[model samples]
Target chain A: MTGVAGVVLQVLLVAVGSPLLVGVMRQVRARLEGRAGAGLWQPWRDLRKLMRKQAITPAGTGWVFRAAPMVLAGTALVVAAVVPLVTTESPLDGVADLFAVTALLALGSVALALAGLDTGTAFGGMGASREVTVLALVEPTILVSVFALSIPAGSTNLGELVAAAEANWLSLLSPVTLLAAVALAIVSIAESGRIPVDNPATHLELTMIHEAMILEYAGPDLALIEWASAMRLTLLLGLLAGLFAPWGIATAGAGALGLLVAAIVVVVKVTVLGVALAAGEVFMAKLRLFRIPELLAGSFLMALLAVAASYFLV
Target chain B: MPDLTYTELLYLACGAFLLTGVMVLWRRDLRAVIRLFALQGLALAAVIGVLAAHQGDLELALVGIGVGALRAGLLPYLMARALAAGGEDRETRPLVNVSASLVVAAALAMLAYAISRPLTELAPSPATRAVPVALTVLLVGFFVLVTRRRALSQVVGFLLMDNAITATAFLTTSGVPLVVELGVSLDVLLAILVLYVLTNRIRASFGGTDLDELRELHD
Candidate 1:
């Protein structure tokens, strides 16, 4: 019963905390731009409105058109379940390894790409092609960076990685961790369709990689995609915060009080990261589509440096 | 007792090699061939996982999962997308037919088994079992690369060759060090990305993924 309760609590935290993180980012961006933003609960309100609205689908769409959002949301939920967002110990921790987490993310992207191509629109197909092209590069960076960390940890489990990071003598100063953190941050932004790699706010089809793919979706479907998108952004950020900046996360065997403290730490860290991401978006313009490859290649090079640094430094 | 005997695993690895060779002969579609390649990866991963889990080594478990995820899951997924995007379906014309290909693959496997037999006899039980299987898979993968006209199949064959090497490493000893295993997997992942990018360019340039067209290249 206690194990089940822990699982339930961790899941609820991820589900509830993700949108709040998104809302905080929006609020921070608005404040940065010298305008009062919507309340932190604004994402909830928007999601509710979207849920109640009628769905409108374009003609000539197939089953994949309807299935994409569900798959994306499902994938995000699975990732949240597997990743230790608030605590190092969770019931579902051992069932999934880091490789599984990576697979879940890749599954989500593939579903989105299929959905984009199913529309038979030029922009959708183009976006789908470009997204996979970026993915083919970005996925390796994610794998390599995490592998560098996993090597020192001696395990591929996320929980183990975090514990090792906390217990290690040079967790923060290790060149491998440093390079991986930077590589992961860049990959996170690219994977989540954020600034420099992709612009989330722009409706201009020519420049939009993520938005262009989902132009045909509206109402409930769009809401789910948007929610899943927010959840994914938060999930990736939380993963980064937990693995790289795992200062306050509840260690295994810590009691309820420890968990509560960890939750607070997590919320604060993710909120701060959300703001930093927003600031980055506010400061930088999106890279050209062709230029996106260079950014991914640079991240891959950084990840390679991380592994080499681990070997040389340690 | 261990869950599986070392000799049984050796014979099983050899059987898996033969089965994958047969799979290569059976597949006609470019995408289907990639799927077979992934299945071959799964078989190798399973054997490695068994060996690692039996020996109670966490490093091998981690390596097993990483290889399974990359070779069986991500690589196959990427290749499938490339094939779909390339749209070269129903147009597969191999450089060699199935019967002739199977005969050649069988001959190659026998040749590899004969070549590795003496060296393997000097090794330990598990290592000896894995050696021939590794060599056969390697030879067949290269054969597939040479015989397949589709660029996608060639890429799958390339990855299969890597899988054979990794399997050999695991069977030859307890396992490679964790650092080497992670590095090799990362290397394979990067190689797959480059392959995907090249496939796209190949599609755009030739309007088909057939290597026959690419052979027209001359400088």
Candidate 2:
């Protein structure tokens, strides 16, 4: 019963809070750049407007284009429920394995990438190709870095991994933790289309990676993609906080009050991470497209080192 | 500060040591390479400090500080001076590209792990277990030396290999005699001074310090 309640709470929190997170990040970036920024409710307002507008489909697009937003939003919601953000006692514990969660996230990305290709626009194809290229390099690091954590935990389940971290807090000081943290941080930035990889603020087609794919999206479809993207970013940051700094998260047998407190703590953690990321973005310019691989490759090396250190240093 | 045991801290330092070596290969800027080499030196000092603290050896601790000063401070300072004189900042051409160099580095690290298995199996202490990291740094430094075209980068490579040797000595046996370590440190300093002068002479004569240009003299 508690597990079920926790899952419901997580889904609701992500659904409502993710847009606010996006708004807060944008507001932070704006403030740092010395501008009068939109309030934190701006994303919610934009979503409201987009939701009321009529949907439009570009010519020659088929089912892939129409269904992509649903797939992406659906996957993000599922990942939100499964990952141990607010509580470790998720109802979907069996599906909360590291590989399952990663694949679910990749499924959303693939759905969006295919939709981009289906639009038959040059920018869409270019964006799809680039996203897939980054994704191919990114997935391994994500898998291997978390695999480093899972090694000592003795399970690949996300809940179990977090539980292990909580159990032996000293493990956080291990070289494995440090290496994996750096690796996962890099991949998270890449996955979320943040600056130094892709500029989320950029609408210029030449430099666009995430934005290029969705230029043709309109009305509620665009809103869904935008909301799903925010949720995805929220989830990645939340996962990083939960896995590495699993201090406040509610564990198995935690009561409803514990679950509520955990929710607040995770919200705070993810918000802090989001603000830091945005502030970091203010100081960074996007890497040239060619140099981006070098960055990802470096992260991959860190992840590999994390895995090796976890094994050999033990 | 979580309560990391001595062995865990030692492992962390060694990890940083090896990571700096790989980063040296990843970066194309000569100044960044020098910076990473300095960082590697600091990591070496960390390895020695951790071991010294674990063993309660004052001599080793003092040696760690001296090595840190020489390798991290004095050596990189001298190298940066050469870099400033040369006026070229990037290692634009190398025998191997960045991606390939990184791949080779990974392979060398794995090889180090494989070959160090017996050595670790023999003693099987935490310090002995971490010898492979030093070995990896040694091989990577050598890789940098052989593959890099610039004299300054080669000097970094030489210093990295030297740092790794120092790390190995500290990790396995705790410390060598203080006099022996100091003698080696002074020798390395003098060697770098010589190389620094050579780099400047080469740059003046050839208008650049690309070692490949030295081959033109054969014709």
Candidate 3:
């Protein structure tokens, strides 16, 4: 029961912490651009403001449009619950595997895309179509890269994988983990609607994919989707950290004090990653839709090489 | 909830194979077929999940849930939107008829059983009851890929085949190493994405995504 209670606490921390990671990243981006940004609580403030504003649905939109934002945010919460951030063991951990996490992310994207098209706007349809096209390449790379790591860990349970990484010799030299980490990093940039895939800052209608879909969203509805998107970005990066750098995750048998320290470490690591992403985005340009596939394919090849290297080296 | 028995899981796998096979034959509506495919994915996930839980292998349980989420939830959602956006919402009439597909499906199942006999013999797990069912699904998926005229159908078939392979891995080994399972599913999803892109192009130039029309590479 204590173990179960610990898992619950870990999930709550991730849920609240996910938004903070976003806040910190935004602060970092602002700093890099030579402008003082909003305080770290800006996201929460934005969400409150959006909630107070009225939602103006596009006339052609139906139930899917109304429900899409909720589902997107809902799925993100579920994914957050399942993924290990501060601890190896989570309550909802066994409800899915790592592949499931990818699927959940993909599922959120699909819902968002469907909502984008349900409005019957050309931009909406175009954005949805392009989103799937880019994702097609990115999704596999994420999976294969993770596979490279799982082989060395010898388990699919995210918790077990973390534990294995802590316990194994192969964990050190597994080129697959490195390849997967790199591949996941690329996919995260793409998946999160960051630079070199789609620009989060741009409203250039022709180039926009993620922004185009949400162009019609305003107020609280838009706020949830945006927050969820940020959380998704943080979550994927946190997953990369958890799986690849499990040094600080509270082991299943660790006490409450150990988990507290682990949670702090997770915050520090995710904050660093968030800052790095902001820096990377500041320096990069969004790739054309056609060119994005090449980027993801490169990640896939790297992951494949990692897996191959693992087989020979480990 | 008493632990789910191996026999129940076997039934679920067999049912999944049947539903997916029938979906290939009965549906021409792309969106409808995608929904059916999602259901088939759920069935596949259920079988794996139950088996994993029964064995108390947390890793397998995770894989089962993950497979369910991806195959059942995400892929189908993507296909549905893609079909809708392309305005390719019609039922795809294949080169072959429904009756022929059923016959082929049965034959494929038999072939799978025959081919899997040696492998099944060597499998140490008691969950081998679904071994033949898994193989048959794979074979049927291949048949759908080859015999179907529509690109979407072929892709769905290809995915079903991948699910069959995943199922086989589960039944034979009780589950794969988590990372390997992750890699395989990722590969399968990636393959589906590639197929989706190709289908989009095929639809754009050819006005439809019929496999018969994709003969530009053919002499």
Candidate 4:
């Protein structure tokens, strides 16, 4: 019963706290670029404002477009519940395997892509095509890198991997862990449609990948998609954080102190990650679409090397 | 002296070496290619350092220092000068395209692994487990040599192949004769100097370092 409580709390916190992460990133990026940006609470205000506006559905769009935002947000929320956020003692621990979680993410994005294609706009089709290309190249790297960590745990379950890592944090120093961490880091940046892969802040049709798909969306629907994007970015960052450094994440059981310790630790970790992401965005140019595959290929090689290193280096 | 950490580091170096080979094919800029070649040389020197520390061979340490200083440091410096002197920017054209060469390079790597399995099994030391990587590096180096059209890039490929073979020999045997190691090191150093001279000569005479220019001699 306590475990179920923890699970529900984990889902609520992740969904609610995720937008603050985006605001932090925006502010950090602005500050890094020598301008005072929006307040840390700005994303919350924007979401609230968006929710009150009228929902506009364009002609030629039917059920798919109408339901896409809800589906996207729901899928992301399900994944958030699946991660061992505050406590590994969640009732859903068994449901939180790596492949399944990654598959759910893919399904959600494919839903968005299908919605984009259904709209019959050239920009939407272009964005969907590019998203699929990025997805195909990135998914293998994600799987292989996660598998590198799971080699020792003997299970693809995310909670078990973190538990195994917490038991022996020294394993983090292994070349396999280090390499896979690097690969995951690159894949995260690419997956989230950030700089160097796609620029999220840009309005130009040529550079927009994620935004183009949502161009026709308005009001509450647009808000949900935007909120869902923030949540997705935060969840992936949390996954990377938990995988590489499971410290301060509750594994055995949590008393009040344990939960607090874990909460503080997670906040610090995600803050550092958001800042790193923003800092990286500061200097990187959006890579030409052709050049993006080379970057992803490099990550794939890193993941492959990680697997070989784990097998032979042991 | 710990086998586990040593094994991990060896595998790490091998991975890095293989990555450098892949990077050489992936990069089009001549300067980046030479830098990667130099990085490979640095990784090779690191392997030498590890092997020497494990075997406690003072002469091997000296060889590592020589190789590190020469191949990783001076050789890259010279190549950069050669590139600057020739005023060429990239390997703009190749017999095999970059993407095709990358695929072929991967196939060549697997072939190197398959071919070297018997030799890897013959070695007694745990370090010999990395021999497949050395052979792969060797073959990938040869791949780079045959496919690239630039004089400096070919020089890098030749040096890369030679370095891989030498690392494999030393890794399997544990230690080479000090005099032999020193002799090979000196020979490479001298050969690079000569190569530099030839690079400059080619540039001066032809205004470029593209080896395709020499094909006009069908006497």
RMSD of each: 15.7, 1.8, 16.6, 2.5
Q: Give one digit per residue, the lDDT tens place, for model 1 in A1-314.
A: 33444456666777887778888888888898998999899998888998999998789998999999999999988887778776767778776588888888999999999999999999899889989988987898899899888887888899889888888635555546766888799999999998888887786888888888888889999889988988888888989998888887777677777777777887788888988899878889887676677567666655664554343233
Query: Between candidates 3 and 4, which one is better according to TM-score?
Result: 4
**DockQ measured for candidate 4:** 0.35
Which number leads on TM-score? 2
Please, what are the lDDT tens digits per residue for candidate 4 over residues B127-184?
7777767776788789889989899989988888887887787678855676887688
Residue-by-residue lDDT tens digits, candidate 2, A107-225: 99999999999999999999999999999878988999999989989999999999989999988988889889998999999999999999988868988989989989999999999
The CA lDDT of each predicted structure is 0.76, 0.90, 0.74, 0.82
Taking chain A of model 3 alone, its TM-score versus the true chain A equals: 0.94
Which residue pairs collide in model 4, if any?
A: none
Worst lDDT run of 10 residues, candidate 2 chain B, spans B1-10
Q: Count the backbone clashes (under 3 Å) in each candidate.
A: 0, 0, 8, 0
lDDT of 3 by residue, B99-195 (tens): 4565455456557667876875675344564576677678878877887877778888888788888777777776677688668778888888888
What are the iRMS values of all candidates?
19.0, 1.1, 17.8, 3.1
Candidate 1 achieves a global lDDT of 0.76
Instruction: For model 4, give the TM-score of chain B.
Output: 0.93
Segments of candidate 1 deviating more than 4 angstroms: A1-3, B1-219
Instruction: For residues A96-181, write the lDDT of model 3, one tens digit per residue.
Output: 48788888888899999999999899898889998988788778777777777778667677878877887763454333465567
Please provide, for model 1 over B78-192, each residue's C-alpha lDDT reduced to its tens digit, 9 standing for 90 to 100: 8888877877754266677554565566466557667876766776465454566577678878887888887877886787688788777877775677788678778878988
